[model samples]
Target: MNQVNVFLRQRKDHRRWVALFLALACVVAYATLDRLKYNGQALNHKQMALVCTAHGLVAHEHNDDCYDEDGELRCPLPELELHEHDDSCYEEMAALVCNELESDGHIHDASCYERVRDEEPSCGIENDTHEHSDACYGWHEELICDIPEGEGAHHHGLGCYEIQMALACGLPEITEEHVHTDDCFVEIDMTPDEVEELVEERGPRRTPSWPPCAARTRWSIPPS
Candidate 1:
């Protein structure tokens, strides 16, 4: 190679090595700083992420928040004991921690468990209060038993109400044991007949916690 070309090539190689070394150095520095931040008792977001990563959890930008493979929020530690409605993280709990931290507007329910924000908030703590059925849907209800087979498809053996509500599904293969709750309902300016027609046309849809009303407010929100 010509001298100039050889010189340029060497310079390019040198620059590449410098960049690689700098990147490695930055990583090391970051790791050292993160470790140093954890003085003794607890961890911040970055340190929590490292610990969570070690335990097969995805660390998020939010402080001490992590997710499991299924995208559900997870506890950071594997050994922190919690009681009363139980901690959502179970390990490094969020409810009581948020209280000590005094994060604006955060509150624990009578059970001492933090209330779940919205059904789809980025990081709502799981209360682990509700039991799951084989398959659950609308009305926030659960079916402990599966829908009965061909012989008694219309009848859900027990813990289900068939008289007040009919199986919403039309397919013969469907066996339903859904129980509708009356705890809460949204009101709209429509007659019963109109609502029924609208429901028939729109089909079945579980209500989402629209507008994240459950989110703890650091500041008051004006209603739309």
Candidate 2:
């Protein structure tokens, strides 16, 4: 090759080496900084991202009161043990996290969070059943049982009625056997008319029943 061409080639090769070395130096610096931040020595993007990912990107403020403190996320309150009611709160946080991610161009990860939020019953519907069913039933029975007085309150199986009531009241489900003090308690899920037919066939509660209201409560007086 000509002398000028060779000299130019050498310069180009030198520039390429210089560029490669600079890139390597930058990578080493970034890696070192990342390591330091993760070890709690510094606050860096890598550490922040990793922490956020570990926490599922969802910042639940209701239960934990997670807030930004000195450029870092910190909880002002102590972590709470999740209860049935916390489902809604978790969903809310998940929503916030997904929204934040989406706004920041983290579309794929945000979509994953959205899916998770959607699958979780965070509307308090599932927890609603557990809580209400547990409380009202607690006053009446040990186990999750049907309401003792059948037909009086139609549409729900007496058991279903009791379960519904307990759930409405936010009581958690229990396994205690459900029993009533009344002498004659029926277990059936029938309409008002069906209940009337059943009661008429079985006869009314025993006279002067041990439970004061048993006779009056069990007798289905036809609605005028």
Candidate 3:
């Protein structure tokens, strides 16, 4: 009888262990399934949403005019809910524009003087008593000079005056004159033919279909 009782207790323990293992397995499976469903839903949402610039041009908050002509004119990506400005963003754009204007030679040489500062040697004329001196400086100044304060020194920085002007003017509408990209209206980076091809490739979402798209697309929201 003692031996039989011991055998029964062992059998019961085995059954309990099996039940526990099965329960654990079921819990793991449920968790996994839940995770998969969540992931799938997220992916679906992303696929349905529209893609836009970092400034959230398509976003409704800041009034940025970003839109989508491609993929069936679907509403702007829902993920881009907020539109805000960034500090360096405008500055970087200004730099890009300045570089472009300087390249075109439409602006004066003084506009890009800062770019080629180190290309020339500086002359020591702090007290140049001549009226014609006018603190004359040029591009490509390699040697450093100790000119008096207020002397014309090449402020070779990231951008030039023309760039600042372009930024101030703001981006133009995307059209035959100014091909638009995901970022901004680009005139210098690509040639005419290349620009056309890029516009076609990026689709209407990037360049937009109208000449006044840029003005319409300006957003008031700041960067997220």
Q: All candidates: CA RMSD in angstroms?
A: 39.3, 40.3, 24.1
139-166 per-residue lDDT for model 3 (tens digits): 5523233343343334323433222311
For the record, the alpha-carbon RMSD of candidate 3 to the native fold, in angstroms, is: 24.1
Candidate 1 pairs with clashing backbones: none
Segments of candidate 1 deviating more than 4 angstroms: 40-224
User: What is the TM-score of each predicted model, taking all chains together?
Assistant: 0.19, 0.20, 0.24
Off by over 4 Å in 3: 49-224
Using lDDT as the measure, the top candidate is: 3
What's the true lDDT of residue 75 in model 3? 33
Candidate 2 per-residue lDDT, tens place, 1-224, comes to 69999999999999999999999999999999888766553222221111121221221223212322233323322222233433322211111111111122222232232211222333344543464333233122132333332323333222221111111223232222212123222233444455447547956333221111111112222222
Clashes of each: 0, 18, 17
For lDDT, candidate 1 versus 3, the one ahead is 3
Superpose all Cα atoms of candidate 1 onto the true structure and report the RMSD in Å to 1 decimal.
39.3
Tell me model 2's lDDT, rounded to 2 decimals.
Answer: 0.34
Model 2 C-alpha RMSD vs. true structure (Å) is 40.3
Model 1, span 59-108: residue lDDT tens: 21322233433454333333222222212312211121122211224233
- lDDT of prediction 3: 0.41
